[model samples]
Each structure stands twice: as structure tokens, then as C-alpha cells.
Target: MPDWNRRSVLATGAALSTTGILAAVGSTVAEEDASTEGVATGDPPGWSSVHGNAANSRYLPLDDGFPEPNTIAWRSDTLYGVSNDGDIAVVDGRIYIVGEFESTDYEQTELRVASTDDGTLEWKTEVTGRQRPTVADGTVYVSGVDRVTAFDTEDGSLQWVREFDSEQWISNATAADGEIYVVTGGTRFNADATLYALDGEDGSIQWKRKQVEARQENRETADPAPVGFKSAPVAVANGSVYAITGGGEFKGSGSKPGLQWNGGVTALDAKTGEKQWGVVLEDGAFIKIIATDAFVCVQNMPDGLEETVLDSETGETVLTSNSTRAATADVRVTHDTFRPSSGPITVSTYGTDDSWTASDIYYFPPLIAGDTLIATRTSESSIVGFDLESGTEKWNWEFDGTPHALAGVDENTLYFKLYKADRPTELIALRASDDRGEGREGDDRDETEPDDDTEDGSDESDSDC
Candidate 1:
């Protein structure tokens, strides 16, 4: 494994993490017959977004229209090798993937797009090594060291690349109304953040909104610091994009006199990149974020202080729970690492621990189709899925390796990459509907159970499932 920090031009710190305060709010709905409402409604379409549709719900909701685990027709081999922290895009019956491989110099970071039907080589594009990639409007968008690039999804050609001035490595982009809205410096600690809207047709800056970091620049100073995104920008209803940036960056050293971090949510006009509304949250406050067509869920910390249902259009706090923030905050939430991949051969592994020892925390954004939510954890090595709406362990699968990404071709099937942390570098497909069972009438236990067995011969412990 290549040490990611050494090759950085700027401070390439940790991945995104969301820590929130809450008293364990219960899942809103119980298990009844699941419906395909917010999830994808059409036939065998390719998995596009990180959460598969801006809603970020990892659910694929293929109502009796997907392949079972027994029917994997083919797979493909990657160039240089495979990586856990990559993604796939499918279009026009072809599968496109950004697979990381070991270079001749032993540095890790490369990307390739393969075919989904037979796992054949389509086109390959190399990137600076990041996990989440958003594909839309016939272009594949990937973020590298200090830049974001758009690739022709069909032939893997470079359409355009826009490099940022600052080294604040940030989160993925959310596309709405033919525009890509993303955050820069949302991941690096104490780094100033700027929200950018990029043109989908060509990689051009449409508009930008800057948020000042309170702390001074400390990259070369004697002081040290821990880096992270205070809040990730999310998409709301109407023609708006919502996210929480900072009053400024936080300093690791306690000697600073200024505020550590200023938290707030800014709503921007999706089409024009105009500032519609902005609110600065209280200090040490964590936002419980969920955006729907009708409402945006912004709940605060420890006492679960305020779970507000804001009007998606007006940005008005329509309703409030008035609870305090929870004690253990919700970790930063983002898109799932992996979606469905296409290639010649697909092989991967998984792991789950009741101990919650994973490095990356994942949440299935509320699947617009019928409120089905999915989540998982990926660390040095492991993968586990839980129902987002109910917090029930759906299926827990473990392996002796680290998986960087996961996605669903259909609700019944899933795809993932097992990095070289504890296992071989390869991709694998599994039965995503393993925990799926017919919902009983009026029973509403809407929980998924563990499967009897797996494709491989390893026996799994069902306790975590």
C-alpha cells in the first residue's frame, strides 16, 4: 500500500467523517412490505451517483427485475491491479469503473473503465487516487490531488480538467439540473472552504462561494493539526444545493483565541449559483441532515437539540422537535464508496465487527423510493450493511481484506472492491438482498436477516447481521 500523505502537494489528510450528537432517534418506519418509492423506478439502468441518485440512498429497489447472486455471467481483470477506494459507472449497457492499481514505483493511484456485460476493457483514465466519482450527462467526474476532471464516459477521453488553487482536498460533487456542485477544503482541518458550481457540458467554473476558515494557515508552521470536513454540502429539494462550511478552519493547538469551528448550512441557487439562504449553527453543534423534496431534516446535537423540518423551497424551519443533541454524535455521512461495476472478472471480500472498528462510515442517503435506507463501515478491512431507516442489521459479511467501494446493479445484487489491506486486490459481487424477505402483513418488522450461506465457503457469524 502506498502512503498517501507522502505524495501530496498539499496536506492530504483523512477521508470525510460526520460526528453528530443525538439520543438514538428511532427509525421512523417498521418493516412492512417494502416499496420502491424514492429509489430508482426504471428498468435495468446503470448505478450513477455515489448514493445512486442525489438522495444518497444506497438501495437499488429492483422490483422483481434483477439478477440473483447465482447468475454472475462474467468479470474482468484490472490494469496494474485493483484498489478498494474506487468507483464504477454504467451507461448504454456498458460498465465503467475507476480501478486503482499499483504503479511500477509502488505508488498507488490509477483508474480504468471496463465493460459491465462481459467485463471487457473499454477505456482507462488515471487520476490522483480518490474513491468517490460522480457520473452524469455522459461525462465521468473524478477529483484528484488538487483538481477535478471530467472524462468522456464512453471512450474514457479527457473532456476537461479544472485545478484548484488551494490544497484543501475535499468531498465529492453533487449534480443537479445539469450542474455539478462541490466543496473544496471540506475535508482538510483548518482549511478555508469554497463551494463551486461546475458546468456539466465542459469542465468550467460556473460560480464559486467562499467560506473563511477562522484559523491561520499552518501547513509549514511549528504547530500540528488534525484535518476533516466540518460539514459536507448536500442537495435539497427545488433548484437548490445545501451544505455546511465553516466560519473558518479549526486549529489543533488550543492556544488560538478565535472560535475553533463555525458551523452553518448554506443554500445556493442550483442553476445560477446564487446564495439563497445561510444559517450559522451553534458551536460544537452537529447537524442531523436529510434532504427530501418536501422537507430538509436538520437536527442538532447532544440533546438532539433541534430536529427541524425546513421547507425545501423557502428554507423555513417548518417544524422543530426541540430535543437536545445526542451524546454520541453521528459520524459525517457521504456517498457509498462502491456502486455496481462491469468487467471480465469480479472478485472482492467483506468483514463486519460488532466493535465498530471501521475507518470509513457510510450511510445510504434516504432512498427516495419508499424510504429504504442502507449503510456500512469500511476500515483497514471490513464491510457491513444496516437498514438506514430502522438501524437494523440487514446482512453482515466479513472477509480478510479491506473494501473501498460498494454499489448495486439491482436491489438484489451488489458490487465491491477488496483492497490489499488484508486480502487480494480484486472486485466482487454479492446478493445485496440477502437480508431481504417478504414483509408480513401488519407485522412491520421491516428488518433484513442474514443469509444461510455465501458464494464462497466461509461461514459467517450472524450476530452482527
Candidate 2:
């Protein structure tokens, strides 16, 4: 399973220069003094950013108080070897993770920041690359294989760092209104993608967008497909951003070999990089986007998993849904590979196909929590949930190991990550039960209704100001 373009040049380093570390990390910090200590009232202030807000629509209307028979309201284990693409960020009460381990003499990556109530710690720092932690306004946006720091959620220090001159990598990052939205490139097979828009206080840049130069109608032996960027740029509320671009690896000419391709969905203008519309998919390549202040939901891949919904103001398209829901859920899950254990998982509802199964063994991709629709199991350690209108199940939660980052859900809490092989990577939190009396019962519905008729509306995009 290596070959994420050869582990993307094994996560490089050295690049910070946009005014050399933004005047050595100091200025930008006042969003009302980045509070929470002042705490007051209001609901959606928990899962602070990254998929939970900014219209990435990882969904979280909060209030049910999550953790129903799901147990474990705390568990830190001090974070040992946590990198299955590490990620967890829940501001105000604080959480922010990102790990990696191996000591004797190499591989590090730290960045802790704990305490969502009990699992204390408060600060750690180390860091190098494996991008993921993104909390905004008070700041805390990291990204490595090249550079893009910016901490200080109140204590974690280091306020600015930019880097990136070429050997790209960046990827996962997104903050709103004050701006952040990263996405770099070059993981070998045709690198070179860009898309900046920094300044969430001081990282600087504001608008970059570069990746549009692949056109070769067989210039004798064919060779012009390396256009980069395949994920990471979701701002949506109408001010725009959206992102996704691919179609690289083609290299075959004498014996015909290399092939890897697929890309499309652009949108830009989150302040003025312009280009407000772009589509591309005729077959696959656009594995997930979300957006929603009314529409933008793409999915597209291998042909049958098509979900299209655009129109976040003018990107057009409207409603497509070949079936695939989970983060917005009207209910839909067929299953062949989100891990697949022995097969059969089905579920169905997004336009019919009439399904129901649930044979177990999923690896993640099915989370709605409230009326339930969880599904975790990629070979045990458990997590069922179901009942999004009677798929049944209702409660399951087993856990001892092997969960690794589900992170998303908060009306009571449901963050995740667990390891086992020698221990160390805990984090958990669970605690979200809607009270079907006690456990396993079914038919409850109404976590806030609106299962899917589209048009729910919310992202007027001042980056969610």
C-alpha cells in the first residue's frame, strides 16, 4: 500500500521564508484575545473547524450530548504511535492531536494540546509532517512535508511559518473568514499543484492558485499530464474555494504501462483568485467534497459511486446522487471497500435501490449520530449504531484497539482513535447516547430532521465568519 506517490518524498523539511517565519512568530493573536476561558453560551463552538465547520459539512448540530452506551468519556494514553493519517481538533475546551512515534533514532511528529475535560496535558509541540490539525480564529494550523505552521490557541506558541518553494506536500488545512485554505503538490507521478490563500492573521499570501498547464495531443510520443492537487480546499458559503484537480500520471509509449488518472471541480474566488466554476468528471476522480450553504456535494469515483449536487451559487449542476451519503445522510451505503470484511453492508435510501443488510466489517464512512448511522468495524474492535429510519442495530461499541481516527460528531461528543499493538495511541471520548431507554432498540429519528430534500442552507462563505 505504499505509493501515495512514494510516500510523497518521505515528508521533507526546510522552506520557511515569506518574510522569514513572519517576523519570527509574534504578531497576530487578537480575535477578542482568542477566548473560551471567557466562555458563555451558544452551541456550535466545540468541534472548532476542519470538516466540522467551514461547510465541509462533516455535520454537527449538537445537543443530544453524544456517548450513549458508547462509554469512555476520556482516555489519553499520552499519544504514542498515532499516524494512520492522524487528526483530531476540538477547540475552546481544547483537544488538537497529530502523532507519530519511533524513538531509538528517527521518525518523530508530536503536537499534542489535550484536555477536553479530563484527559489533560495542555501542550506538547514537536511536529514535522503528516498534516491534519486545523482550528481557526484563535489559530493552530499545521502542515509539514514543506511548511505552514501557525500555533497559539492560547498557549502552544509559534505564531507563523510559511515555507514551500517547490518540493510540495501540504494537503489538509482549512480555516475561514480570516483565511487559511492550503493545498500544495508534488508527490512524484506528475507533481506541481498549488492553491494558497493564507493570512488567517499572519501566515500572509491571500491568493495563489496554480495548476493549469497540461495539454498534449500526442506531441510525437505523448507526455503532458502532470497537473497536481487532488484534495483539500473546501471553504464554501458562497464566497467560494471548493478545490480538486488531477489527471496526471500517463507516461506509456513503447510498451504501454503507466496510467493513474482522474480530476475536476475547481471554483476559486475566496477573495479573488477568480475562476468561479469548473467541473471535469466524465467517469471518476473527485472522491468527496461537501460544501453546503445549499449545495456542492460531489463524490464521483470508479463510475458507480456518483453524487454530484453543485450550485453553491452558480457552479450549476443541481442534484445528481447515484447514491452515497454518510456525512449528510438521507441514508446510503452499498459497500465493497471502505474496508469490507466478509462483504454485505448495504443500507439504502438516497433514491431507492431497496437495501438493508449490515453484515459488519466496514472501515469507516457512515456517521450521523443522533438518530444513529455510525458503522466502524474494518476487522473488529466494533462500533455499530444504525437505525437511521430502521436499518436496526442501534448500539454496539466494543473497542480495545484498531480504530484510528474517526473524529467527527458532537452533540455530546464522539471523537475517536485507538491502537493496541503495544498500546499508546488512545484519545477516544465517545459518550453520545440518545437514550433509546438503554441500548439497542431502533426507530428514533429527529436529531434535527431534514434528512435530505437538499437546500438546507448555511455557508454564506465569509469563510463562516
Residue 37's C-alpha lDDT in candidate 1? 19
lDDT by residue for model 1 (335-424), tens: 222233111110111111122222244322212122222223544233444433344445455545444455435344455554554335
For model 2, what is the alpha-carbon lDDT of residue 93?
Answer: 73
What are the Cα lDDT values of the candidates?
0.42, 0.54
Please report the candidate that would top TM-score against the real structure: 1
Prediction RMSDs, each to the true structure: 17.7, 19.0
Give candidate 2's whole-model lDDT: 0.54
What would you estimate as the lDDT of candidate 1?
0.42
Q: Report the lDDT tens digits of candidate 2 across residue range 232-319.
A: 5555454566776666433212111343335556665555455544545443345357764445666655333455555554444645
Best by lDDT: 2
Candidate 1 backbone overlaps, count: 62
lDDT of 2 at 196: 74
Worst 10 residues of 1 by lDDT: 342-351
